[model samples]
Target: MTGIKAPSKRQLNNYLYDRRREKFGRAAIYLDELEKWIFDGTTIPDDENEVFVFSYHVIEAEEPSFRLALSTKKLLNIVCSTDILHIDATYKLIWQGFPVLVLGTTDKNRKFHPLYLGVSTNERQEDFQMILMALKKRFCLYLIT
Candidate 1:
């Protein structure tokens, strides 16, 4: 009675789970909002729209995986300045169990700076190739010259 009452831990956990379920159940809405902001120039970075759908795969008419690549002019310059690029993957960041792929490079002082980040259904060769193709297409001129 003296202290403010808070929901029990189990109750709190259930509430969080329910909220997550509701959000995931409406994934389309979330994607739509994100696309609207990006394409409508509301979320442009450095006066440029740098977010791209690097890969999208659907099976049986259901989208299983969607990989979005985030980039910016500054990030791209850092990427091109570094001679070595490092690609790494992490898991369990989301409840869906998709792997988050990170593409980064080190600066002259050996500090790692991430350039592109994506989440994919699996670590298939094709998935990686798709990412590589997108990066190549975007930076081919910078890389060549």
Candidate 2:
């Protein structure tokens, strides 16, 4: 053999998937470390990365309930400059089959740009309310500079 064999695309995908699982954890329960970090009120934003965790509620119980909202400063600014906020939820995209709530705004052209993403243990009115409350909280805690 004169040349080294190259890994297949599937091999690359599996490698990436394994790496992702390792880095992010295999399940929602595996998120304890990162969750604890954010729950400790330690999330900060800078020039390189814009992701921010604005609001979260972690309830300890037989079946722990976790609700979190995530967004960026730029997205918040975009949300403010636009009208017609769109909010919706979808299920089964993440572990524990939690519903991921989405927030965005519509432009004059009716294009939807994503603003915030949230996850709740259940898709109930209360869950939605908490998520919105979390979104509201962002303004008070984090001011655009």
TM-score each candidate: 0.61, 0.71
User: To one decimal, what is the Cα RMSD in angstroms of model 2 from the true structure?
Assistant: 5.0
* Model 1 agreement with the true structure over 1-145: per-residue lDDT tens digits: 7797989999999898889888766433444555554355324344333654433333323553455565655566566566788887877454245678889987778888788776666788877887778777765433322
Report the number of the highest-lDDT candidate: 2
Clash count, candidate 2: 0
lDDT digits (tens) for residues 63-145 of candidate 2:
87778888777777675566588898876466457778888988888888998888888887888899777666665445566
- Candidate 2 has what TM-score? 0.71
Report the poorest 10 consecutive residues by lDDT, candidate 1. Answer: 52-61
The candidate scoring highest on TM-score is 2
TM-score of candidate 1 against the unseen true structure: 0.61
